[model samples]
Target: MSDTATRPEGRRVDRTSAPQQGSWTTARIVKLVAILAAVVVLLVLPLYVEEFWLRTGFAVFAAIIGALGLNLLVGTTGQLSLAHAFFLAVGAVTYTYVSGTSGGTANAYGGLEWPPLVGMVLGVLVSGLAGIIFSPIAARLRGIYLGIASLGLVFIGQHVLNTWTSVTGGFNGRLVPAFSLFGFSFGGTDSPELVIAGVPFGQTERLWYLGLALCVVACWFANNLVRSRPGRALQTLRDSEVAASVMGVDVRSYKARAFLVSSMYAGMAGVLYALSIGSVAPDSFGLALSVQFLAMIVLGGLGSVTGAILGATFVSSAPLVLQQYAGSLPFIVDPGQPGIVASQAAAFLYGGAIVLVVMFEPGGLAGLARRLRPTTRAPGAAIAADGADSSQHSTPAPADPSTGGDNR
Candidate 1:
């Protein structure tokens, strides 16, 4: 009897102590190496790329930031919004009107002449405030109804941009002040020219670095947000608002906060967009812009920050690149040519892609990328990693009272 008991305990101990094989160590090293390689490539790219590509890259960065913001709202919170362009317009106009000097076409508009950095900060804040003001409506409405209500905001904002002549320069638009920080202007240098690695670092190059830095920060912050507690709440809310409420999530508050965060991101993107275009016009913040933003999140894989960046890059750069190579490509032509315009071609491509993504792969690019990854794991590896055994994880059966606490 004693030997039998000892044998059973010995077997249990041996099973618990058995070493498990895993590929996690190798997988982690591979992931680290890949990240380093990508960072190095991005860092060195500017040294060799031409000015046009650099300019396009900056625009893509701005788009990426905007897309990330929209993903937070529509993808994460499950709220439909078409007023993103309105917020962008608010940011661009605020930045321009605040930083720009007093003088314009017919001297009709006025400006505060604040520092560019200050203007950028104020622009983001104003956009966020606008979002907060609209949050009440967002909280009340759901689904497509909310989408339509938000759409109305875009039309209202466009009208405001057109009629606010003194502030917005009416219909002609206003010039965007070049971004500068502490006397370092991100514009053409007139005296003691700036140079880097025997190459002149002009406005485009400077803006490229600025955009790159902001993009990195935005991506990092978004990833963190997605993985944190609030992110989980948002995801739960998206899955089922009633369930989220049962789980103690303040649905209304979270929804409102999501709007504020998303709009703030749009505001930042707007500032960058103004810099990229060198002007802000009423026509630029129409319904078309909002649709493009929606397409970015949809095509990139909803709720994925990295997907947002990828989608933005493709959407924002495709048209510019196509236009640049229109003559070399077939069927695509210049803006006024008989054939397809670059913008039209890009729209057709993304529109088709959106339909395919929705119909076939609801997860979008991110989900598709995950599907290509290997899912198999070493046996018992998960249990070992979790530091739990089957017995520990499950409820114990009741012991027989007559058998000294033993079931058998």
Candidate 2:
């Protein structure tokens, strides 16, 4: 007998004809395998990579955090901000001052000598506070006006960094205190030695792992934030403030909150930047720095978490890599060599890339990735499957007696 059940209306239904649930398609299995393989490669890379590359990796990690933050504000929330460098400076300077010891010499500097963790936490808080304070102004402006208003913060921060001699070390800058956790250091050669697979884990290696962990956490948090309800609200706000307001989303409040959260992420990135460079200088956190971050989000694709990471990696690493290999490359030379310097060359390359991406692929790298991804089924396959199932399982309805004949 056919595997069917009779309904009250004299119709037969085939329970087995339903589509399969939770079945692992070939595309899904391939994606899972690819992700696992990439994770393994990232985990093992520090063991075999050189110290220079490890240092570059740490810088990339810091940039990734910063880019993610910028993407959330400008990309996801449709807020234009150029004060990111100011917030970064706030975090870096706070960490340096809170954790560093006073300079006993003529150019004296201040310090709290607190635990590094405390310094880090305070750095993030102070940066967030700065953002919160400026958020009111941000809520009042939009587009280039908001961006221009935010740009003022960078100048203000620069002035403070230069004149606040005791805290910021004046024009020359101050050393960043080494980070330690309960006496275990992630900086310097004096920390307890660690051996992994016959390779001595030095300061670079230790910092590499630390950076990796932090980057992972940053990515995870940003991904979750982008997928949450508030994320949807932010997207709505980006699309149309009136629509968002009608939907009961507090536009001003969310804008303020976005600034606060983005600033906090910049703070974390700033702390890592201080660690990577071993110093906090006023000249380092300038308008150019803010512009670089803007380039990152734009190149990576606005509103994409993965795109932020990719853009950060490219923008952060390009100049360094070009500088490293400049001697062998044509048309590129060292500073003052009367040729295209590595930094300038790198800028041209990415600037051109941005133009191309804008012209050809408006969605950026993330959208390109989606376009290239394999589909689980052929075109029209799902429709065909549904039709086949309906033909096999669904029964013709009973004739309408009231109409005195079949309606068909």
- Candidate 1 lDDT, tens digit per residue, 178-213? 899888888744423688788877888889989988
Candidate number achieving the greatest lDDT relative to the actual structure: 2
Off by over 4 Å in 1: 1-29, 106-108, 189-192, 376-408
TM-score winner among the candidates?
A: 1
Query: How much lDDT does candidate 1 score?
Result: 0.88
lDDT of 2 by residue, 1-408 (tens): 777777655655565554455656566688779877977888899888898999999999999999999999999999999999999999999999999887644226668999999999999999999999999999999999999999999999999999998899989899888899899999866789889899988898888888888988998899899999999999999999999999999999999999999999999999999999988889999999998999899888999998999889999999999999999999999988898999999999899989999999877888788888765663345655766677677677678889887757
Q: Model 1 residue 315 lDDT?
A: 87
- Candidate 1, residue 130: the lDDT equals 97
- Model 2 superposed RMSD (Cα): 4.4
Model 2: which ten-residue window has the lowest total lDDT?
375-384
Query: Which portions of model 2 miss their true places by more than 4 Å?
Result: 1-32, 104-107, 378-408
Each candidate structure's TM-score, on Cα atoms with residue i matched to residue i, is 0.88, 0.88
Error of 2 at 33 (Å): 3.8
